[model samples]
Target: MTSLVSTSHLQLAAFALGTVGWILCTFSMGMVEWRVWHVDNTTVISSGIAWVGIWKVCFISYLHISPGYKEQFCHKFSGYDSFIPREIYVAQGLLLIAMFVGLVGLTATVFALRNVYMGIAHKTLITRFFLVGGLCYIFAGLCVLIPVSWNFYSVAQNQSISFPPSYYMPTSPAAQDAGAAIPIGIVAVILLLLSGTFSLSYRFPVATNTTVNPDGINLPSAVSEQEQSQEIRTTSRVIL
Candidate 1:
C-alpha cells in the first residue's frame, strides 16, 4: 500500500507536469498564430512557435517517462486499459490532423492579409475560425486526458479489480465508466472539423466586396456618392 501511494504520487506529479506543459504549448502556439502572424510580425511568430515546440517536446517526454502508469492517480479512476484505448489513439490522431489544418489556415490567412492589406474583415473571420478549431483540439485533448487521469487514480488506489477480472468478460463497472469518455472525445473532434471548415470559408468574401485601391486604402462602396464627392472636394481644397 505504501508502494502504491508512492507510485500514485509520482504519477500524479507527472500528469500535472504534462498538463501544464501542454497548456503552455497551446498558449505559445496561439500567440504565434494570433499575436504574431496575424499582427504581421514574423519575429514574434518564430519565437513563439519555437517556444511551443519546446514545450511539446517536454510534454511528450513526460508522457514517455510515465508511460502505462498515468491513469491511476486522479479522480474518476478507471483502470489501466482506460489510459490507452484504441479510441483514444484514434482521437489523438484526429487532433494532430486538426492542429495541422489550423496551422495551415493561420499561415494562409496571414499571407493573404499581408499581401492584400485590405481584407481585414476576411482575415478577422479566418482568425476566429482558426481560434475555434484550435480550441476544439484543445478540448478534445482534455477529454482524452481526463479518462487517462481517472484510470491512473483508480490503479493507484488499487481499484483495478473494479474492472472485470477478465478482459473478455461482459461490461464491468470500470469498463462502463471508461467507455463514457470516448463519445465525448469524438464529439469534440467533430466540432473541431466543422470549425476548420468554417475557417476555410472565411477566406472568401461572404458579402459585397470591400476591396482596397492601388493606394492601399479600403473603400466601402456603401458610402453615398455625395459623401465621396464631398471628400474629393475637400481633398482638392486642401491641395489648393
Candidate 2:
C-alpha cells in the first residue's frame, strides 16, 4: 500500500517547493531586467519580465492562500498571515527597508570577498564568495518583494486602485553605474572557482615528522674538578 503523507509534511513540502520556484522566478526576472536595461533589447526583455512577474505573483498568492487550508486541517498554521491584514502599510514599509539593507549587505559581502582574494586577509575564500552570491540573489528577491507587497497592501487598503506604481526605480546615475556591479560579481565568482580548484588538489591531514640524534652529545670528564681552579672562559655569538 502507498503511504499517505501527513498534512504537516505536505505543507512543509509545499513550502520548500514554493521557495525554490520563487528563487528561479526571481533569477529569470533579473536576467530579463538586465537585458532590457543594460543590453537595450526592449522586445524580448519586456515579454520575459511580464511573464516572470505574472508567474511570481501567482506563486506567492498560492502560498499565501494555501496556508488557510493548511490551518483548517492543522490549527498550528493559523497565525501565518495574521499581521498581513491589519498592518498592510507597515509591512510594505518594512519590505522596502529590507530591500535597501539587502542591497548594501550584498555589496559589502562582495567587497569582503575581494579583500580575502587579494591576500589582504587570510580567511576562508569560498565561504566569503558563497556569502556574496547568496546575498546577491537574496537582494534580488527583495527587489521583487518590495513591489509585490506594496501593491498588495495598496489593493487591500483601496480596491479602486488598479495597482501601485513601481516604488523602487533606479536613479539615472544608478542605472548608469549598474554595469559596474557585473565586473565585481565576476571577480568574486572567479575567486570562488579558484578556491575550489585549490581545494580539490590538496590531500587531507598533511603530516610532519622530525628526528634527533643522541650520539652528538658530549660529556665533561672528572678532570673538570682540578680544572675548576683554573680560569674559565665563555664566548657568545650573535648573528644578524
Candidate 3:
C-alpha cells in the first residue's frame, strides 16, 4: 500500500534558510568591499579608501582635487591580471561556482517539497530528491566557505595588492581591515550548512499494508493493495 507523508516542519525551515543564504551569498559576491584599505597619501588620491572584491576594485577619495568634490572610481579585474592575488582569483572562481550550485539546490528543494506536500510521487522518490538537494547545498556551502576563509586569512596576515596607475590605488594602506562582505559570506556559509543538515534529517515514515477481514477470512491476493490505496487517497481528497 502506498502512503502519502506530510512534509516536515524542519524541512520547511531548511528551505527558508537555504534560500536566504543563497541570496546573501550572491550579494556578498557582488559587493566590492571584501577588503577595505585606507590611504593617507596627500600627493595623489589623498584621503582615499579602497574596496577590493573578488571581481573588481573600487576607490573613493574625500579630498582628491578639492575638499568639496568627491571622487569615486572602480576597475574590473582583467582575465590576465597577474597583480591580483591567488586567493582573490580562487575566491572569484569558487564563489561563482557556489552560486550556481546553490541555485540548483534551491530548485531541487522546491520541487521536492512540492512533491511531498502534494503527494505527487512516492515517498522513496521524493526522499531521493531531498537527499540530492541537501548534498548540493552542503557542497555549495563548502565551496564558498573555502574562499571566504582564505581571503579573511589573507586580510588577517596584512596582505597587500598592487594596483595599476589607472586604478590610482595605493600599493600599501595606512590601515587595512576585513570588509563587510567577509562576515556576510561567513554567515551565508553557516546558514547553508544548517539548511543542508536539516534537509538531510528528513526520514520516511514506516508504512504497513496488512488488512484484516471482519469475517476472519483473508482478502484475495488477486486484488492489488496499491489500487485500494490510490482509491482511498482520491476519495479523501474529494471529501476535503
**Cα error of candidate 1 at position 152, Å:** 19
lDDT of each residue in 1-240, candidate 2, tens digit only: 111122123222322333343333333333312111222322322212111121111111111223454211111112333322333343344434433543444444445444433544323543454344445434434444444444344333432212212211111111121222223223323333332232222221222433333576443443454453442322222221
lDDT (0 to 1) per candidate: 0.35, 0.32, 0.83
lDDT of 3 by residue, 97-178 (tens): 9899999989888888888778675677778878888998899899889999999998888777888877778787777899
Among all windows of 10 consecutive residues in model 1, the one with the lowest summed lDDT is 50-59
Candidate 3 stretches greater than 4 Å from native: 1-7, 62-70, 209-240
In model 2, which runs have C-alpha deviations exceeding 4 angstroms? Answer: 1-91, 129-133, 136-143, 146-158, 161-240
Give the per-residue lDDT of model 1 (tens digit) for 75-156.
1212344533443344345445444544444444344334334434443654464445445434434543443344334434
By TM-score, how accurate is candidate 2?
0.24
List TM-scores for all candidates, in order: 0.27, 0.24, 0.81
Name the TM-score of candidate 3: 0.81
lDDT of 1 at 52: 10
Residue 207 local lDDT, model 3: 52
Worst 10 residues of 3 by lDDT: 60-69
List RMSD in Å for every model shown: 21.3, 21.3, 9.2
Global local distance difference test of model 1: 0.35
